[model samples]
Target: MMESQQEPKVTIPPLIPLEYSNRMMLKTILECGDDQIGLFGKTVVVGGWVKSSKEVKREPVAAALKPPTAAEAFPPSPGRKELSCVEVVQSRIPFFKKIIRVFGVSSDSYPGVREKFEPVPKPPPPPPSKFFLQISDASSISSLMVVIDSAVVPVSAGHVLPTGTCILAQGVLEKSSSHGKQTIELKVEKILHIGTVEPDTYPLSRKRLPLDSLRDYPHIRPRTTTVASITRICDTLDFAAHTFLHNHGFLHVQVPIITTIDSEGFSEKFQVTTSKKWGLGSGSDADVRHETVKAEQHIEARDKSKLGTGVKPEVKEDFFGRQSYLSVSGRLHLESYACALGNVYSFGPRFRAEKTGSIKQVAEMWVVEVEIAFSQLEDSMKCAEDCFKFLCKWILDHCPHDMKFVTKRIDKTIVHRLEYMMSISYERISYREAVDILRKVTDKTFETKLRWGVPLTAEHLSYLADDHYKRPVIIYDYPKAVKPFYVRLNDDGKTVAAFDMVVPKMGTVITGSQSEERLDMLSARMKEFDLSRDQYEWYQDLRKHGTVKHSGFRLGFDLMVLLMTTGLTDVRDVVPFPRTHGKANN
Candidate 1:
């Protein structure tokens, strides 16, 4: 056997910093200094939508711009008197101090300094010098004031830069201590671009609009403060989730969105079809199948009992040579990878043929599914809890301002809820105990009555998390009748090693279980669930081969955001262009 040669390792350079060679974000400029003092005299290019603009007609006061000073130079410049006003624009700070000469001062040394100072002539007041327009780049909750000079820039401030108008400009930043508020104001020397919006038709013309009304303009909903804050929170939460998963030695695997197997066979699936009949293409076999379908268009004479035979010519014409649907979950696919990779996860959109128009239910949603090899129900719960807690902490650390704004305007107890979840461990109980607690509840009446064999409703989940435990609670060992066949059968024989993590306001945020690894036990469960054994040949092959005990869970990413953000009540509000039952226009 020949020995393999070792390849040389390549060294990668560090990433180049992007402090705006082309353009800078408002966030970078806003946080550049101690109260923005660091931005004095530094020129930058910035772009954003105009939140507010006003034409300020004020008389030019050079004294306000320049401070008075009395100091004598041994040799005063001849243009010192003429350059007094010009120096104010050049230097922000005053350069002279009043020094009284007690000793006899020489005439040559005090040539410019005299007992009585010459009065500087007041210059004529200039025309409406500039208009102040406030703009924000959606990167931060705060806005920067742009001092637009009409003579310098051709764009009309009042008409061209309305509430929803967008613009890009390059200018020098000057310190503005207006009304004792120390802030940085961009002195607009050039206007790069202007995106004007008609004031009469603009929906966000007002300073504040009702949250419900903003839902109508889904395209521009992110322009609002509430939506922008929610967006930042959601983005950070996404990164936080990825960070937690990567840190825990879980390999992220991409699962197919278009799948043949219905991982969760219990739910209705959205059928994937094409423009052609039976989803057939223009191949020779497709042509024959098309002719056969046309010939059997009317089956009134055919025996109805023969319909049980699925060997119809049209079935072969179907896409993938079998019926396929959008994946409702990635559990089965993740498990296949988990068995090989030891631990794996998949994060992507999962579609459901959901007709329910509830605030929490949507046709399409993003899910984070994880599978841990050589693990059981407890391992799944532990991983879920750690990931959940890390997400909450990440949001709190990264988006403190947004969270505060949300708390003051949306939900006041958001911070408390997150802190409570992080400070305490999630309570764990079995399905039977959860049912018992629900049965003993006397304060509130639930719409769905408590039953041992039936699935828990939103009401039951809420009661357990909010009222019973007053925190997040994990309920495990669900009844076999309620859980899917993939879940492992517990020793009790009546329940499965399945679990659900219920959050305070979000209800069930995560649900997972130890997969049935034993071939005979899995086959028995499949038989009991009335699932087709032939269709899951590959799944069964795993159990027949090197299948070890493995477990995993699925978390609704949107619901987790709602729980972390606290104020958001609907999952649609957090998701951009939410595809609900009747609302997919945008």
Candidate 2:
């Protein structure tokens, strides 16, 4: 079920007594451990893939004449002679059972002082011939041994229960007194095999798989512990993002994925087109140029015609009648809703036609773009800080178990990093001040020289956040020439009111700025970019009517998850179905 995207159909027991009905309570391995003490004499069910299995032969013994003491039990007295007792030889088979406990001990005097239970015995375990299963339910894993007779589940000598076979078992919880120690374990009565895998053919067996190897089988990789744990954390991140916005009175607005405008003015976007039946497929640049020139000549000829008649000139119809592309950002469209709704946010897929395959870049990724009316650059920075902090705290409180896996295997300092980020306020620095700090640093050589007007690279960003600041740093008031034309120009006319939030390890998780609200300023800026005037008339109208100072920032939702997860360095590994240059796999 974890390997597939479809939700599993769950069956729950009706309200009834544990002993009265045949139905068994479905419990997770973690839940089973919590109720270990109280679950005695109760019938419950658990499902997981079998880790190991073995067959055991049972021998019959006659009625005991007297009871045996503790020392004379299974690990019989070292030097004691064997008892001569009659044995009724009958054929029977036994299964394995072992105990697992999930709990902690505490004292009332010191409320915070706590202790864990003693570790399970490491010496001799149950006989090797019994069935054993290391079961995982994507939350916690446990070792489950079948303690049933062969009569319950008939098996031949040649029959084998291979690893990675999914199964559901109905059992009663009980304490086990085996060769030397006592432990709690399940005693299975009936079992059903949901699916079986051939040990020789299964790609993901019990062996530890490398992260890169898992990428080759994305469809089934979620069934593995690492991927499954990451998927769970991603779900929490998605919920936390929306919850933070909703709490701040931000309305969730759905924006179009297909748009006619390149919102960021980057010109890097995926073109959307229907089946090319009208000479639209596979054309060279020269051919496209020739066709464009022909279309222009036809329009010019029609315009030159003296239309003394009342009928308007006929126009050719085509798909959309204009070049449209997948949206690079929803910030432009979001402004429309923001102006009417006060504050609005869009969370969905955004595409880019970039060919680079850097760890931080992906062709298709999700972004959380926000827009706020009647606000300025400062307000955008404050809102970004508040929303980001909320998400960090939410994950720490909600997904501790999954986080433990990340902290243990990936970056050991992830928890501390997040805690520090949540504990202190984000420091703000002007772009010029940031450059000055970099210039003063003589210790490390920067690939890109420190300069006032140049755009900051990842190296510069990491140094500012991780090496110098030792925390998230917000650098604002970037040079106007290097920033988007829509960013509000300062009174000095040299720098624009733009900001970027950079954190240690992950550079620039959020980027935004106050937008130009003056009609003349916006028009002049658009012209500087060489964009067609008619294409932006709608955007310009907002300023002509009643535009107020507005600002907002966009956060790469998957990139944020990568930062929170610590050692996960690549955005491709974090996002499901990664779309990269020359690669788009389902």
Number of the predicted model whose lDDT against the real structure is largest: 1
Per-model TM-score versus the true fold = 0.79, 0.74
Give the Cα-based TM-score of candidate 2 against the true structure: 0.74
Q: How much lDDT does each candidate structure score?
A: 0.80, 0.74
Error of 1 at 254 (Å): 0.5
Off by over 4 Å in 1: 1-21, 33-35, 58-129, 180-182, 277-313
- Judge candidate 1 against the unseen true structure and give its global Cα lDDT, from 0 to 1: 0.80
- What pairs collide in candidate 2? 99-184
- Candidate 2, residues 1-586: lDDT per residue as tens digits? 4776787544432323336534333333234433455556657676665556655665444444454432333344468765322111111111111111112322344433223212233333222234544455454423455465555555432333676677677787666535423245567777754566777777786567887777677786766777777887888989999999998899999999988887767558887654232234248978877776776677667657736554454322336766678988888888888888899999999998988968888888899999999999999999999988888898899878778878987889889888888989888999999999999999999988777899999999899898998889999999988887788989988899999999888898999999999888888888878777787778888888878889999999989988765459888778888888877757
All candidates: CA RMSD in angstroms? 17.2, 20.2
Tens-digit lDDT string for candidate 1 (307-360): 678434455556577778899999998888888989999999999887986788
Off by over 4 Å in 2: 1-34, 50-129, 139-150, 155-160, 174-186, 277-318
Q: Which residue pairs in model 1 clash with each other?
A: none
